[model samples]
Target: EGIFELEYLDLEIGRCRILEPVKVKMVVAKTKEGFTVGGFVKTALEHPCTRCLKPVRLEINGVVEALYLPKNLASFKREKRLETLKNVIYYTGNIVDLSERIIEAIVVEIPQKVLCKPDCKGLCPYCGIDLNEHPDHVCDKISQESDIDPRFSVLMNLKKNEEEG
Candidate 1:
C-alpha cells in the first residue's frame, strides 16, 4: 500500500477546479493473467452552484480499479485480449501509467447537479437577485401571476385537484 499524490490534473468539469492534490491509497496484486490494482481517491473541487451561481466546494471521493497486462498479450489469439476483458490496459516494459484510469474514476463520482446547499433558494428568474440573500424578496409582477403557459393549465388543474382530494 502507498499514498500517491496526483498534481495539477485537468478534469474538464464545468467551471470546476481541483482544490488540492488528490490523495490515493492503492494495493497491487499479481494475477496469473496480469496485475490487479485497486484503490480509493479523495479530493475536493470548487464550482458554481447550478441554481444560485454561488461558489460551491464539494468533497469528492472515488474508487480506482484496473487490470494491466503485457503489450504482447494483445496479439494472443488474433487480438483476443482487447475484446474479452473490459478496461484492460496493455503496457510495454515495467512502467504502468495510472493517470487516465484515475481520472475516469473521479469523473464517475462527480454529482450531476452541483448545489451550494440543499436549501439554496437560487436566483430570481425575473430580476436575477439571489433569492438566498433575500428570502422574502418578491417581485410585484411575478408574485401575483402564474408563469406557466396556458396550454399546461389543464395539467396544473389536475395537480391542484389531486392535492385537494
Candidate 2:
C-alpha cells in the first residue's frame, strides 16, 4: 500500500480553469496480475455558465481507478485484448505515468449542462437579455405571435369552421 500526492498549478480542464493548486491522492497496490492505481481529485474551477454565459465558480471532485498491465503478457487479437482489458493500461518500461488518466477522470466530472444555479433562467433568444437579471421582462414578440404552436396549426381551422356554420 503506497500513497502519493500530486499537485497542479493553473491547470486547464476543457474551457474551465483551476483557480488554485489542486491535489490528487493516489493509492497504489500490488496485485497478482499487475498493479492497481486509484485516486481522488478535488478542485475549484471558474467557467462561463452554460445557461446565462455568466462567470460561475464550481467545485469539482473526480475519482480515478485504473489497472496497470504487466509487461510479460502474451500477445492476443487486438479486438479480444481490448474487450478483455477495457480498463487496463499497459506500460512499456518500469515506470507507469498516471497523469493522462488523472486528467481524463477530472474532465469526466464536468457536467453537460452547467448553470449558475439550479433554476437559473437563461438568456432571452429574441432580445438577448438575461432572464435571471429581469424576471418580469417580456419580449414584444410574445404579444405579436400567436400562442398556438406551429404543429397545432392544422387544428386551428376546425374552430373557424364551426363558428362559420
Candidate 3:
C-alpha cells in the first residue's frame, strides 16, 4: 500500500501528451511463482479530436496487475507458459522493475475514439472548414454537380421497376 507520483513517463503515442503527474498506488505480495503487483493509476492525457483536429484532454484511470517471475525460472518449464500470458515480466535482481507493468495498465484504459463534443460537426469535406463554427456552410462546386455518383447510376432505376407494368 504505497502512493507514487511520477512527473512524467516516457511514452510515444502519436500526438498524445501526458498533462499531469502519473499517480500509482500498488500492493506487492510474494507468491509461489514470484510476486503479484496490483494497483490503480490515474493521469490526464491530451489528444487531438478525431474529426475536427482540436486538442481534447481526457482523464484516465486504470487498474494495474502483473506477475513478476525470477530469471532462474526462465530456464525451466515456467518460461514457456510466461510467453502466452499477459502482463508478465522477468527480473534478475532483488529490485523488481515495474515500469513495463505500469505503462501497460495505463495504455489499456485509454479510449479508442475521443471527441471534443458529442455532436461535433467536424470539417466540411470540400472546403475543410470547421463545420461546428459555421453550420450553414456550403460548397458551390458540389451543389452544381450531379448529386448521384455515376458509378451507382444503374441502381436508380431499381426503385421504379418498369417491367412490372
Candidate 4:
C-alpha cells in the first residue's frame, strides 16, 4: 500500500507509488507546461551512534519537486536560477525519472550523526566498558596515590619544607 496518494489528471506521465511501506511517499503530476513530481520519505533504520557504539534509530523526511519544460526553453534566463530550479525541477522529455531526485532529498535529510538517546552514557574509555547499563561501575577509577607522577614528588617535598619553616 502507498503511504501517500496522488490524484493526477493524466496518469500516463505521472503516478504514485510507495517504495517502502510507511517510509516513502511518491507523487507524480503531468502538467501542460511540464511534469511536476515530488515525494515524502522517511527511514527509522538502526545505526551505531558516533559517541556510543549502541544502536540508534534515524528518521528522515523531505519533499522532492520537479518540472519538465520544453527542450528549447530549457535555457530560459531567470534571476536566482539555481535556487528557483531547486524547488522547481526541469525536464526535457515527456517522462521524468524521479527516482534519483526523491532519493537525493531523503539522503540530504538524513542526520550526519545518530545518537542512541539525548543523554546516552557512553562507554568507559579506560576499561572499554558500556557505562549506560552499569552506572555503579568503578573499575575505571584511578587511585589518588597512583595518579601522582614521580616528577611532581620534588615539588611536593619543596612545598612541605616551606610550610614547616
- Output the number of the lDDT-best candidate: 1
Which portions of model 2 miss their true places by more than 4 Å? 1-14, 71-74, 77-86, 140-165
Q: Could you give candidate 1's per-residue lDDT for residues 43-153 as a string of tens digits?
A: 876777889988787787889888888888777773565466677888898888887777777778877888889998899998899999999998765644387678978
- What C-alpha lDDT, on a 0 to 100 scale, does residue 121 get in candidate 1? 89
The C-alpha stretches of model 1 lying farther than 4 A from their native spots are 1-15, 75-86, 138-165
Alpha carbon lDDT of each predicted model: 0.77, 0.72, 0.76, 0.59
- Expressed as tens digits, the lDDT of each residue in 44-154 for candidate 3 is 877778788788988888898888888777678755667777877778888976766667777777677778998998988777899999999886656533765878667
Predicted model with the maximum TM-score: 3
lDDT head-to-head 3 vs 4, winner: 3
TM-score of each: 0.65, 0.66, 0.71, 0.53
Q: Global lDDT for candidate 4?
A: 0.59
Compare candidates 2 and 3 on lDDT and give the better one: 3
Candidates in order: C-alpha RMSD to true structure: 5.6, 5.8, 5.3, 10.3
Clashing pairs in 4: 67-89
Q: Write the per-residue lDDT of candidate 4 for residues 3-96, one digit (tens) a residue.
A: 4332211222222233333455666677775666666765444456666677555555676666656666557775464456755655565566
Regions of model 4 farther than 4 Å from truth? 1-23, 31-33, 59-61, 68-74, 79-85, 88-94, 136-165
Q: List model 2 lDDT by residue over 38-119, tens digit each.
A: 8887776777788888977768787888888666553644456446755787777888888787677767787777789999
lDDT, model 4, position 50: 62
Q: Give the per-residue Cα lDDT of candidate 2 at 151.
A: 84
Native-to-model Cα distance after best TM-score fit, residue 39 in candidate 4, in Å? 3.3
Worst 10 residues of 4 by lDDT: 7-16
